[model samples]
Target: MTRQLVAATKALLVLTLVCGVGYPGAVLLVAQLVPGRAAGQPVLVDGREVGSHLLGQPAGGPGWFQGRPSASDASGELSGGSNLGPSNPDLAAVVADRAASLRAANPDAAAAIPPDALTASASGLDPDISPAYALWQVPRIAKVRGLDESAVRRIVAAHVEDAPLGMLGQPRVNVLALNVALDARTAGEE
Candidate 1:
């Protein structure tokens, strides 16, 4: 019994060290070494860091690009999804309100509202949105920034990232990155 207990204890310690410490350390090392993906791809603006590329944030001003809806608190540590089904009345009301706000903000835009602009993502922390969603806000953003619509559209186009591996997913625009670029451009114009 004593020998058996010793053997079990040794095995448990070895397994714990291997899985908990060694595996995580190895992964971190590899991630840091990867090109264009190190340090979790933090977003920067004008030589200063603003936010991470993995989290969503609120861009309340019309001059900035908006990110996906977030169920997290303002600090963004406690993240969650609303989890309301499509038929849920509360969800429907929220969507309607968002749509109305978008329409009011872009009264002159001829394009139909995109779903991503109105609906919350599943994680509620998605950093990217569909390119269509960004385009939908171009008119409002351009007006607020006092920039030409074509210029805002060009900025959006420049920031649009293709789907991973060319076909693995839909094209997306990283909202935080785009908004940073917008602010930089505005600063340049000043």
Candidate 2:
């Protein structure tokens, strides 16, 4: 019994030191080598931090591009989806309401609203939106910012980031980055 207990204790200590301490330390060292990402890739404006590029946030006003509807109210710490099934009535109602609001805001968007606009991402923290959705808001943003529609479209086009591995996922535009660029452009015109 004593021999077995000693052996088990030794094994536990060794495993804990390697798996818990050594592994995590190595990972932290590796993560630190990559700049900005370890700190959540914050989006800055005029040297001031505005928000994280990796998380969803309100786009401020009609002049800014909006991201997907977030289940956590755009709070990064409380990440989760609504988890409502397709047949759920509440989900349908919420989507309908969101679509209505979007139409009201962007009356010139004649195209069908993209699904990502009405539905929150599975992680409730997606910072990107479909390119179609970003384009849909061009008219409203241009009108609100008093900028030409073509200029706004150009900004959107420039910010469209390709998916990882090229074919792994759909292309998306980061709302925070796009908005920051919009702000910079508008500021430059002043």
Candidate 3:
């Protein structure tokens, strides 16, 4: 029994040091060396920090590019999903309301809306949206920004990221990055 206990204790200490200390240090070192991905990939504007690529934030104004639904609290530290099943009445109501608002805001868009625009993301903290979802809001965003719709659409197109290694995932646009670009362009124009 004593031999077994000593062996277990030694194994635990070694594993803990290796995983808890060495692994994290190596990861941090590598992250620091990467370009465009260091320090949490913070989104900045006019030399000021705005948000992060990993988190979603509310874009209340029409001129700003909106992110996916956030399941996080206002502070964005506690992340979670709505956990409402598809058949939940509350989920249906919320989706309906969001669809109505999108329609009202973009009367020129097609009546059929994208699912991403209406449905909450699993984590509710997704910072990206489908390229189609971003395009759907272009007309409304252009109108609010007093910019040409084509120009705004072009920016969205430029920001559209292809799937991982070409085909693993759908195209997505990081909302915070797009919005920051929008603000920078608008500021430059002014």
lDDT of each: 0.83, 0.92, 0.83
Q: What does the lDDT read for residue 37 in candidate 2?
A: 95
Error of 1 at 47 (Å): 2.7
Which prediction has the highest TM-score against the true structure?
Answer: 2
Write one digit per residue (lDDT tens) for candidate 3, span 1-190.
9999999999999999999999998988888788567666787666888888877778868778777665564245667778889989999998888888888878877647888888777777788999988988888888888899898998899999999999998999999889888887788779
Per-prediction TM-score to the true structure, in the order listed: 0.89, 0.92, 0.83
Q: Tell me the lDDT of model 3 at 51.
A: 84
Between prediction 2 and prediction 3, the one with superior TM-score is 2
State in Å the error of residue 19, model 3.
3.7
Candidate 3 backbone clash number = 2
lDDT measured at residue 119 in model 3 versus the true structure, 0 to 100: 77
Per-residue lDDT of candidate 2, residues 44-160 (tens digit): 777999999888887787878988998898886888999999999999999999999999999999899999999989988899999999999999999999999999999999999
lDDT of 1 by residue, 1-190 (tens): 9999999999999999999999999988888777457675777766887888877878767678877656563245766778888889999998888888888878977898888888777677788999998988888898888999898889899999999999988999999888888888888889
